[model samples]
Target: MMSNRWLILADDLTGAADCAIAFGRRGLAAAVTWDVTTSGDVSPDDSRPLPVLAYDADSRGLSASDAAERHRGLLERWLEPDRVLFKKIDSTLRGQPAAETAATMAYLMERTGAAFGICAPAFPATGRTTLAGHVHVAGRPLEDAEVWRRDHTYASANLGFVLGTAEIETTLVPLSAIRSSDLASRLARIAEGGPGVAICDAETDGDLARIAAASLAVAPVPFFIGSAGLAHALADTLAPAPTGAVHIPPSRSGSLIVVGSLAAASRAAMRRLAAQDHVVHLPVSPDTLLGDLAGRADLAARVAAVIAAGDDALVEIAIGDALDMSLGPRLARALAEALDPIATRIGAVAATGGETAAALLARFGIDGIRLVDEIEPGVSLGLTLGRLSIPVATKAGAFGDAESLIRISERLRAVRTQGSFS
Candidate 1:
């Protein structure tokens, strides 16, 4: 059977999500994934998913050769090391910038069969920026253009696409090709959207929390925003909720849970909401954070611990980063009383300060991590272990994520429904 998986070469995580939205518009369930390189700061109790992943400068793999090796390993784990796609945006820069992008593209395409789509005018509507900071297929270069087109406006704008890009195929949304939109309509659609899941991966808490609230406007499902940075951004809004807080009513879809951040007050409030409806352990408490992790410091230590513990042959062993105080190791130690060696890969989604996260993961000696291009800079939407083979993950406290957190809840629900794993 042909694989239905769709991969995108986006400028950033937001770009990845936008592309996923495009895929969703084209009638497909899409998830914008990122790899975590930092330490843990998010958690999930009875609700939420762990965020994505990232690797900051502190990682031992920061060296050119090490980074390349890391990417190669990841590529081997996922797509072919050489057959991945390269998506480029258009802008203006000098010599080496363009040369490097082209060289990288050429290397991937030539050695890996990954041809690229150079978008001259980077995405206009969104804030996606060109990495090389230059233009591609700009100006009069549209002589052979097909799917690509011109962009009207952007920070650095222009437009073009590959000659015959396929549906969901790799395409560049240069700063130029981005289309503008009305804030009102966008908010309305998001608010009125059906009950699924509302995810916020913005760089700051204010912007992301605002958007997260908007997603909850008309939808009755659980609302989850990745990354504490974004969560704190909207802390005020989420705390009192202007559009109104829809308490976790029994009639609603899923319970509300905020993982990934130690914004103590906010996490407490969310749990209180869930408690009102008697929803099973959502809105997790900071006190439950077993490790005595007081934010960044705690997370860093967890990363070091994860590295030292090693993946070994244990199946689970909390297969993730250690968020909160109740680390995967401690949890594992406790589980040994009755459980088998199946590690759960826990506490993998932590999005504290970039540098701090870096320190933690770095100390962990996780020699195989690398940063994803889109989730690198400019665009935000921080999620820990957001995308990877990690089977389980959670935010530190009430900082909720979509994929990993939901998976945990759903699995538990299923286990209860079917006889008893308990």
Candidate 2:
């Protein structure tokens, strides 16, 4: 069978790239675009429609109503009958997932006559799983996870409760039904009634695979609501097709590594990466970035000098104990502005946070990313599409290990040297 065309919608840049990379790895051309207001913004190329197109609504940090409106507007313009919808949410239940899902369901119902959502946000490879309708990260409930403590929109980790905030009717499909022989029938029964979501339980890749298969077999073809793990499961069920090849940009200079996430995993990875002999760590305080233009310029110059010297430059925002989450976007924009001058001096770019990656790419005049491969479980490697067509790797704030940044840096360098992932 020919591969299905997908319209994957994510709330952030990293989520968009990672989920789209699932199909990209399956040999389908996948592209991710952010800040999309017009239909033309999502086009990967003028030649043809891509097999998988993931659009980042950039709504993760927005309020519930605003996030819902964003998703509705995008779907209004881009939701086609032939294209399958995959609503990508954070695995750890961050951002405005409840609002987003409700918006998606309402739109799909209005447009397609019926709609049902299949939510399975478990990414086993990254140590995230859903059991009893609650998301677990590395064997701990999402409520107890560091990411939730740092940032959360819900009172509980239960998927049902989260979805309930938006008044979305959800059915919890336990592990028993997921592992049973008549899984498809069970899903069909749940989706039989008018618009409702089913929160499926999954502990491993195999369970996710089963969920994907059963959901596909059901009527109305329920729109997916999950993370990259579910996207991977869906991609695995589809037969591989030879699509257009991704263009790999040539290496120009040393790679630029930017980490703007406050997650402990990202901070640890940044430290490990900075320890490399060929890497120079350029740490700037949030205060300096937000206020001191001269300091920002000097930091940019230092970054350029490091790249000119054939050494990797690692740019990180120094966070203090009294830091507020509300300052994240301003800090990200400031950091991006500081480094915008050195865009031409870098060969490849690796960013750790979603907002950070989006800001830097926008500042550097990048329209979108054409995903090519996954460097690790949650890290995606792609080539930027506009003024700067260079290798860009993105990782979520809470994903990956201490050595993840090092591995990503090496991957970008290798791609620069080889001209292709092959």
Candidate 3:
């Protein structure tokens, strides 16, 4: 039997939750935790080891060297002989994926004397695909996507080129080979050649499944690298027995919807959600959040009142004509600080963007999230495991459509009414 132990390392909170929830949906107990220090909280329930534990290094906004170091530190502390490691990278290749992948490979080589990586960063369900080694978003090359134009560390969308930036050797496994019957043997042969990363080409979930099976068949169990789509494929390969039941806490109050993502998808979702009669839209200007404490307090009070009256509160950061990507983290922190006073009044929460989710949960004193179910292809639902225990739905900034936020808010409300998710 394959070892059930698995560890997923991600650069941000949403990546960790979405990847971890892939296993959770397979009936395996999974949890996501961040801010992992030597003595920091590691899991929701440490008494019994979870089958899957995803940790966010919170390095998405860090410099390349800092991001690499953060990943290395986590691996040194959390990696174990019994656990399989899945290094999660942004589907759009937004952050320092090359630095982090190189760091991970170096650590594994040092520990086991042999380390091979099989990277398939395609998440076809969300329109992210890799063809001829270049990443595409919704039929457009990544370079042409809004996300890449707004923020990108690489000059090209080619996977090999991205990995080469860190001087890490790579072999491109074309889609033709991935679809062949002898794919397992081909991948095995590639691994036998020595320590290097295989950048696989995948344009669909079936392609990713083939890659997952082939990678697992290789000796030494190569570490997997990808987004939630690849993680879902791996989880299917493991096929752990599902747990019997899940306990979801009851709630009588309204849900809190926070939007701090700059993605056009999230902004559209917020707009659709605000159209609902029971949701009170509360928009906060970036300048007010950063400079006006009185204004921030007033917004928080309005949010509390709206929730107190059994209505969902939608809090969003107002975007202007041109906003700097660098202001994301600072704006997220400011939003979190503004909402801190109303934490206890919130029955459930739905947050967009990793930084926004992480900041709010941290400010609310949450240490971890015990993943229960996936709300959508890339949206994860969990129960916060510290200071306050409540159902929280998290989504990557660019993963969903206009109705995504509406579905999440309704799901949280339904869970609260039913008093359980399972």
The number of the candidate with the highest TM-score is 3
In candidate 3, position 157 carries an lDDT of 92
Give all TM-scores, in the order shown. 0.28, 0.97, 0.97
Evaluate model 3: give its lDDT. 0.89
Instruction: Give the best candidate by lDDT.
Output: 3
Give the alpha-carbon lDDT of every model: 0.27, 0.88, 0.89
lDDT of 1 by residue, 340-388 (tens): 1121232222222222233222233322221111221222221223222
Residue-pair clashes per candidate, as listed? 81, 0, 0
Candidate 3, which segments miss by more than 4 Å at Cα? 37-43
Ranking by TM-score: 3, 2, 1
Error of 2 at 100 (Å): 1.0
lDDT of 3 at 299: 93
Error of 2 at 361 (Å): 0.7
How many clashing pairs in candidate 2? Answer: 0
Distance from true position, residue 377, model 1, in Å? 20
Give per-residue CA lDDT, model 3, range 257-345, as digits (tens).
Answer: 99998899999999999999889999999999999999999999999999888789999999774987778889988988999988998
